[model samples]
Target: MAIRGYHAHLYFDPHEVGHARAVAEAAQAAFGCPVGHFHTAPVGPHPRGSVQLSLRPEQFAQFAAWASEGREGLTVFAHGLSGDDLADHTQYVIWFGTSEPLDLSIFG
Candidate 1:
């Protein structure tokens, strides 16, 4: 079954901090949703500096479109919150650039 919510991880390198912020801000501005705090380094199991946005299913398609086109050179890790963490991060993900290895232990 499809999940009712989604989480998008916006990854950036330290040098690209400003670009990362721009993307997150644009997402908040466009979607009118709360974006997570920006991290300059990997927080938890993330492999790079990142920010996150959580959106309802209603907002997923719109956000996905903007994310897919607006990330510039940054990478995005998007997945559903369908209760199965492993499948959610792997099978159910959409990538805007190269996929990064996540600390999946956090999910289980």
Candidate 2:
């Protein structure tokens, strides 16, 4: 089966929080979707400052394409929300740039 929706985690360095925020905001504008909190510290198992956006499957391909335009050096970690957190974050995810270490045990 195809994916239902996705959660895109936009990770950034400490000094680039603003840039990340702008990227998230631009994504919201470009896609007309909701952008989640801009986190300075690790949220749950995430290893860096991150912002999240939930995208329906219909929106995924376009969003991924737009993101590949190199939205100012942000590392995008996107995964499907298939009711299986572990697999979603691990096996079914797409990484645009370096992947960060996540404390996946939280999903247990």
Which numbered prediction scores highest in TM-score against the true structure?
A: 2
lDDT of 2 by residue, 53-93 (tens): 99998999999999887466788999998887788888889
Model 1: per-residue lDDT, tens digit, 1-108?
779789888998899889988888888889886789889898876899989889888998998889778887789998898898788887888888898888878866
Collision count for each candidate, in order? 0, 0
Candidate 1 pairs with clashing backbones: none
Question: TM-scores across all candidates?
Answer: 0.87, 0.92
TM-score of 2: 0.92
Can you give the lDDT of residue 107 in candidate 2?
Answer: 89
